[model samples]
Target: MAIFLTGVTGYIGSYLAAELLEQHGESLNLLVRAEDSQEAQRRLWRSLQLHFGFPVFHEHLSARIRIFCGDLTSPRFGLNDEKYDLLVSSTDSVLHCAASLNRKSEKSCLNVNLRGTLEVIQLARRAHDAHGLRRFSEVSTVAVAGQRRNEQVTEDSAIDWDRSDYDPYARTKKFGEHLVRELLPDVPRTIFRPSIVLGDSRRPETTQFDMVRAFVFLGGLPVLPFRPDDCVDIVPVDYVADAIVTLHQSPRPKYEIYHLSSGVNSESFRELTAALAEARGKMKPLFWPELEAPFRAIVERLSRRRDNLGYTASRLEVFLPYLVWNTVFDNTRVVAELRRAPAPFSSYCFSLFRYAKENRFRYPYREWPEIATLPSTARDSEYSESARHVSAGEPAK
Candidate 1:
C-alpha cells in the first residue's frame, strides 16, 4: 500500500521518512512544503544525509518517492485539483506528523496544530471516499495531559483543560485530538502521543535541540528548581519513529491511542544530572525549591552575566513548567503492541551530551565559540576545569 506522509523535514518526520522508504520503497508520497518540487527534494535529501548519515540514499530517492510541495494549513494541502485527486487516489495511508511546536504563542500553535490537523483530517476523508484508505496515523504529544503534576498519565487520561493553564503547544494538540475524534469518528485512525523525544540512542544525532536537549544545557547551571526524584519521561527520536511506523503497519483496531514514551524506565532529575555530569566530567547541579529566594536571586544575578550559565539559566526559566512537574506517562499499550521495551535515557544521555558539546550544541549553526566562552567564577569552577582539561589535550576529569 502507498503512504502519504507529512513533516518530511521535521525531526521525527525525517527519520520516519527514511524508515518508511526503507520498508516500502517507491510506494511513498512525501508532502513537503517548499518553493517547488526541486527545492522540496533537495531539502529532503539534505535532511536524510544530515540525520541519517547516508548521502547515498539520494541516488535512489527520486525513483522511490514522489515529493509534493505545499502547505498543510491550506485546503487539499494547497495542491491543485488534478494533483489533489491524484494524491487521494494513489495513497492508501495518511501519516499526519506536521505541526507547529511554538510553545509561546497560542495563535501560531492553533494555526498549525489545530487548523492544520483539520485539513489533514479532511484529506483523510477524501482519500477514504475516493480510494480505499487503510490507515490514518496522527502524531500527537503526551503533553496533552497538560499540567497534571505528580499524576500517572495513562493512554486514556482525560485532558484536564479546566484545572491548569497548559503551554500553547500542548493546548493546541489537545484541541487537535478532540477535532480528530469528532470528525473522523468512524475512520481507521490511530493517535500516537510521544513524550519528550531526545536524540538517537545508537548515534549522536538530533535534528533539533529543544526541550530534551535544553535539560542537558541546564546541567551547567549551579542551581535548578527540581526534585531529585521528579520523573522526566524522555524517549529517543528513533524509538518514537520506529514505534509509530510499526503500529501503523500492523493491522489493529479501528481507533487506538498509544503513549510512545520511556514510561517506567524514565529517569529522574538527579539521574539525568548525574549522567550529564559524568559525561562532562563535572559536578552535578544542585536542586533548589522553585520559590527559593536565594536561588531566584542567584538566577537573576547570573542572568546578567555574559556567559553560557547565564544564558542557559534564563532559557531554563522559560521551560520551568516542564522541569517542575513530575508526571509519569503510561506506555503499557505501546509495550504490549511492540513487544519490546524502550531504551532508557541513561544509556544514551552521555552520547547526546558529547555530541552536543562537540558540535557546540548548534549543529548546523556552529556558533559554539560565542557560547562556549565562560566567565571565571566560583560557581563555574567545574565547567572551567572541564574546559581547561579538554583544551590541554586531556580527557575531562
Candidate 2:
C-alpha cells in the first residue's frame, strides 16, 4: 500500500520523504502546493538536491514519487473528485508534516497548523474507513509545552494554554494536537514531537536556516541575555527523520506521543557558545542575566535605526525567550521505541555552526552582503566593550 505525505518541501519533511521513498519505493504519494505537476516535481527535486547535495539519486527517487499538487488548507486537499477518490482508495497511511512556523502571524499559524491539521485528520479518517489504513503519523513540536519552564517536559506533559506569553506557533500546535486527539479518538495514530531540529549531523546541508541560524548569528553579539545552565534541546535532522520513520514502521503502541529530542543530552547555552566559538575561532560569547532589560532596550533603539543591527535585533527579540528557557524535554518513549538514543547535541552542534557560517546563514536564498557583515558603528563598539566586561564576570552597567 502507498503512503500519503505532506510538507515534502520543508526541512524535515524533505528528509522524511527521502527516507520513506528508500523504504517504500514507488508507493509514496507526496502532497505539494504548486501551480501544476511540473512545478511540484521541480520543487521536490530542488528540496532533495538542497538537502542531499547530489544529483545521482534524484532520478531514481523522482521516478518513485507521485506528486499531487494541492493545498492541505482546502477540503479534499483541493483535489478534484476523481483525484480525491483515487487518493482515498490508493493510500494506506498518512504522514502529515506540513505546518506554518511563522511566530509573528497568529492567523496564518492557526490557519495552516490548526485548520490544515483538521484537513489532514479528515483525510486520515477517510483513508482508515475506506482503505484499511494502518497508521496516521503527524509531526509536531515539543514547544507545545509552552512556557512551562524549569521542568521536565515528557511526552504526556500537560499544555498550559492559559499562559499569556506562549509563542503563537507553540500555542497553535498545542491546539492542533488537542483537536487531533479529540477528533480521531480511535485511529491508530502517532504524534512525534521534535525539539529544535538543526542541520544534518552527517552532512553539512539544511533546507532552511531559521531558528538555529538565528541563534548562531546572535553569538556574534557582545552580550546576550541568557543563563549559563539553561538547556537547549536540539536534535539533528537525520536523527529526527530516522526516528520518525522507524517509529512508523514499528508496531503501533498504546501510547502515541513521542519526543524526538536530545533529552538528557541537551546542550546548554554555555556549551553551545563554546562549540560555536571553537568552530568560528572566536571568543566565546558572554551570557549575562542582568543584560536582559538593557539588551531589550538596545534592540528597541536599534530597531529604529533601520540598519543591520536593527534587523538582527528585531529577529533576536523573537527568539530571546529561548535563551533562558529552562525546560528539558524527556524522550524516553522515543528512546525505547527506536531501541537507541538520539546523538548528543555536542557531537553535531559544530557541524551546524559550520554549515550556518559557510552558507552565510541563509540556505536556498542568496546572501545579502549588507546584512551578512556587522557594521562597525559606535553602538557596536559599545556592545563589544560590554561583552568584554560580561566575559570578565563584571556587570554590564
Candidate 3:
C-alpha cells in the first residue's frame, strides 16, 4: 500500500513530499502534471531539488516513488482504465495538496479548486470502496475563513456561510472543503489550514516568491498605508508542512481540522518592520492607517500598467485584503498536538526579505544534470515490487 499524494510540485507541497520521503518509510504514488514520464521526472526534480540532491532523488524515484502523469481537472485525472486501476489498487491513503491559488480568476479557481478536488475525491471514493482507504488529507487554506477582521478564529468557527470571501481562490476553497465533507463522509479525513505561509525558517532560499515579492515591495516603502499594530499572521513553510505530515500520519489526531497558524504569537506591523529595518540599519517605515483607502486606489491604478511596477502592484492588490484584515487563525490545536509553536515570522522575515531582494525574487533552481542516466519510465511491476518491501515504519531501500 502507498500514500497517493498530489501537488508534489508546489512549494509547501514540496516540503511535505520531501519530509515524507526523507523521514518516513511509505511508498508514495505521486500525481504530477506532465505530458510524459521524462517531463514528470524533471518537474519532480525541480521541485524536490530544494530538499534532495540528484543522487538521492534518483534513488528514491526508482525505489519508492511512482509517478502518475495526469491533469487534476480531467476525468479520472485523465488516466486510462489500466493506470487508474493501478493507482486505486496500490493506494491505501491520500494527501491532496494540489490547488489553484490564482486569486484573481474565478474560472481558474472554479475549474481547479472545485472540479479538480472533486476528481481527487472521486478517486479516493473508488480506492476506499476497493480496499478501505487508511486516511484522506486535504491541504486547505485559512483564506477559506472568508473576510475576517481582528478576531482570532478557531478551526470550527473559521467557516461562516454568511460571510463573504476575499477572492475567487478563497471562495472556491471554502466550497472545496464542503465538497470533501459532503462527498466522503465515511472516509477518515483531515483538513489542514495554513495561514500566510512565507519563507522557510531554516533557510533563506525559496522556490515560491509571489508573497516574498509583495512583502519586498511593501518593506521598501518609507511610508506604508496600514495600521502598525495590526497583527499579520505569518507562519513558516517548514512548520506548516511538519504539522500536516505529523498529524496526517498519526493513528488518530485529536481534531479533524488543524489551523497551522501563529495565532496570538503573530507579530505586529511595527515589530516586523522594526526587525527588517534594524537588520538593514535603516529607519523603520512609517505607517498611516488613515491613508489605506487612497493607497488602495493608487494600487488599483498602478495595477493597470504593463510594467514591473504594475505586476508588483497587481500581486499586492490580491494580497492587500489579507494584510489589513488583522486577523489570525488560532493554532492552539496544532501547537498542542505538535508540542511546538511555529517560529515567529519576525525572527526570519529579514533573511527572507534580504534574500528576495538580492536574488531579484527568484529561486536559483538547479536543472537536471545531463550526465544523469536514470530511467524516468519505470514499469508498474518495478514500482509494485518496490512497494511491497517498504512499509509504514521501515525506510525505503
Which pairs clash in model 2? none
> Across residues 75-94, which tens digit of lDDT does each residue of candidate 2 receive?
87788877787778878888
List the candidates ranked by TM-score, beginning with the highest.
3, 2, 1
| TM-score against truth, every candidate | 0.84, 0.85, 0.95
Q: How many backbone overlaps does candidate 1 show?
A: 0
lDDT of candidates 1 onward, in order: 0.73, 0.73, 0.89
Pick the winner on TM-score between candidates 2 and 3: 3
In model 3, how large is the Cα lDDT of residue 185?
A: 97
Find the 10 residues in a row with the least total lDDT in model 3.
Answer: 384-393
Local accuracy of candidate 3 as per-residue lDDT tens digits, 1-397: 8999999999998999899999899999999998877677779999999998877777687678898989899999898889999999999999999999999999999999999999999999999999999899999999999998889999999999999999999999999999999999999999999999999999899989888889999999999898999999999999999999999899999999999999999999999999999998999999999999999999999999999899899999999999999999999999999999999998988899989888887888888775553344444323533222232223333
List runs of model 1 lying over 4 Å from the truth.
51-55, 253-255, 290-318, 364-397
Which candidate wins on lDDT? 3
By TM-score, is 1 or 3 better? 3
Off by over 4 Å in 3: 373-397
Which 10 consecutive positions of candidate 2 have the poorest summed lDDT? 374-383
